[model samples]
Target chain A: MPSLPDMATPEAERLAQEAAQPADPHITDVALKPALFDWLCRMGDGALILGHRTSEWCGHGPALEEDIALANTALDLIGHAALWLELAAEVEAQGRTADDLAYLRDAMRFRNPQIVELPNGDIGRTLMREFLYDAWHYEMLLKLRDSSSPRVAEIAAKAGKEVAYQLDRASDLVIRLGDGTEESHARMQAALDHLWPYTGELFTDDAVDEAVAEAGIAPRASELQGPWDATLREVMGEATLTVPDRRADVHLGGKQGRHTEHLGYILAEMQFLQRAYPGAEW
Target chain B: MVTDTLPSTDTIRNWLGEVPDPEIPVISVTDLGIVRDISWQGDTLVVAVTPTYSGCPATAFINMEIEAKLRDKGIEDFRIERRLSPPWTSDWLTPEAREKLRAYGIAPPIDGTAPDGRTAARAARLAGRSNLAVDCPRCGSTDTEKVSQHGSTPCKAAYRCRDCLEPFDYFKCI
Candidate 1:
């Protein structure tokens, strides 16, 4: 079956023309200063660490299809990490490459949220954590798509689609397991409770977030609260899972480079190749 | 700056067009809408490219292929500039290219511009509604179900036609 050729709309043509311009003034003036670089590192680290954790399931997923899905999701996250870290390196201007930033940094120097660094306890826990994180990530990327830094905006634009798909998949699983059977529902609920405290850290704004927000590089983490809450509530409702109490004490400090105990082990494993053989190339 | 020894931009573009996409062999890089811009700086030729998917593993290979093709054409002092702004969209796939993809048994993307003509498919993706109905390439049936959101490559998704019961890849809306 032959398909019709996609005709370029006038708007698309205009966008194409705009892209062809020698240089965008908005892009030329946007430099990855210290604050922006820090913000980018936080974003990149979250993806990298979570991607590493998810990759642990590559061959062990419950089913063949799930194995492929998890691997693909891991690849997407790592890909986003590469973009963010590459930009961070460019801003640092210390001759650091994406790999350098990814592999050379110790656990204490990493800035991913506490939630992503935790162990993937079970399929229930894993999907619950992913669902929560993906929701925030999807909302965050939507705002980032309009960042003053054209590079961030572009990366967000490309990565947002992948995150959306992940969110959909995770949400589906959450609903399925939450409403499936008594044991399954109980397991998912328990996972939700276990992962809930870590989510508060995702929205706690700090100096780095403030600076980036001021510089138009990213939105304030606090700004994502409403959307994140609404999404969580809606998905949980469909899944027949109870929403955890919000007043519970929140976990914090991952953004400030202090991570949970799990992060150190993750770093040790992930950076082993580079640390053992510096400058190793595939 | 024009130099007597250098080929024209048109000549360079045509030569680059001959380089096929490493993954989708039936289509050229240009057909895939990856070769965004070609320019000259001093004596060096700059080819700007955007990856179809940010995490696409084929990006490095694609760049290598382009470099090899240019070198084979006896062009030296060239650099491949990776452009992120105006990130690649399936909408950029030219009409001719879409037809070629369909002919190759991979369904091309739907017209990203819906009836309102403003909402491009990428926007739909950002809104988390990417599973747009895709017709089967073999039986031309709209009744198809997505078997998996992923396929052999990052750019495509797996689907099976309800009518034909044939599994195929849908060049995903992204």
Candidate 2:
């Protein structure tokens, strides 16, 4: 087998090559800078992958009310994804539609953070993951509502309301599960412990985020950290849960298209119908 | 009264007012304030619409129904434009439509001093806990409790009234 460093070099080179090329050759608009376009895709891809995971619980939730709630949340995320991806397609100036970006891309091309692509282990784990993400998503949307790009601003303004509700639902559920029976409390704590390391990736800033921030299209990912921490601390405090200590070696690189094993399975299931029957529409 | 020229914008708007909402049959599209604007672009008529919520599944159906209704009226050259800014809210529901929702056994959203209090409340709810008072349509009592945030449809919430002991869907302020 090749050495770990040798494997890393080729992947890094491939990513560099991919970055140099425009997502679509047909895109001729110089105004839509490549960095900003990538940032938009990152936002949309995160929502799409996470939304797909949430939708898996459609008929299998612990309770009837929860089943409906999860489905509703999934729909909201998917809707937000459509808006962002549609904008991304416009920025690319290609004939590619939102569905093209969503269903056609391979796992290696997705820009979603690794945290969202992780398997939904259980209700406790799922809500914990969602709470972490929704808090950051809500804060980011709050800032994006004033984005310099009119399209981004419009999409953010509409999606902000939906994300707020998602944050509320997830926060409430985390508190309920954390403060409930002994078994539930232990499970919730364990879920948080398992997922805590992934939380750091949500606030990791890179060139794409910096470019988008400079252009006033989105707030820097680092700027969201303080508010995210405050919200998590408050919610966790109320739930009688402790914030796990940050690990020094947090997994990264999902923004650069490197993902966990789970993404392939998700793509396989989500893209099956679309790939099998191209141009299939209802 | 018939003429070779197409009907005026006012006439088309009036005809659209007769098209009932697919989900809430009691309210017309115009009454629900989903129809934002109507204008003529060359020979084709354009109707601007905004969905009540971003992810509302009813939007496509509403668009299709609007097109079919206009086509049925012998006006085939029409297009629907979706407007996202000035987003749709429950406040847009006309007073007449509010009454109709109540009569249909669904609680109408509360009118507030703020233009879109529900949207505002959602932001507030994230910061802390905020609750909106939804009066029961049956007993007209203020004693009601939210059972679940998710309801039969995306636009409604499940609520139960204490006095009437009946569960009803509240057209939640969005």
Instruction: Evaluate all candidate structures by whole-model CA lDDT and list the values in order.
Output: 0.79, 0.78
**Chain B TM, every candidate:** 0.85, 0.86
Q: What is the lDDT of residue A134 in candidate 1?
A: 92
User: Compared with the true structure, what per-residue lDDT tens digits does model 1 show for residues A157-267?
Assistant: 878877876787787778778989999999999999989888888889888899888878788999999988988888898799998876533778898888889998998
Per residue, candidate 1 scores C-alpha lDDT tens digits across B1-174 of 333678888898888788888888998998888898998887878788887777777777777778778888888676676777676878888899988888899999885522121123234445564455788888888988777767777777788888989999988765
Q: Residue B131, candidate 1: how far off, in angstroms?
A: 5.8
A173-260: candidate 2 lDDT, tens digit per residue:
7887898999889999998898888878888889888877877778998899998888888888868898887671297889989989
Stretches of candidate 2 above 4 Å error?
A: A1-32, B1-6, B112-131
- lDDT per residue as tens, model 2, B1-174: 144777888998899999999889999999999898898777877787877766677776787788778878987665676677776777899999999999999999875423221244335446564445788999999878877777888778788988989999988765
TM-score per candidate, chains pooled: 0.86, 0.88
User: What is every candidate's C-alpha DockQ against the true complex, given to 2 decimals?
Assistant: 0.21, 0.24
**Top candidate when judged by DockQ against the true structure:** 2
- The CAPRI-style docking tier of model 2 reads acceptable
- Tell me each candidate's RMSD, in Å, in order: 7.5, 9.0
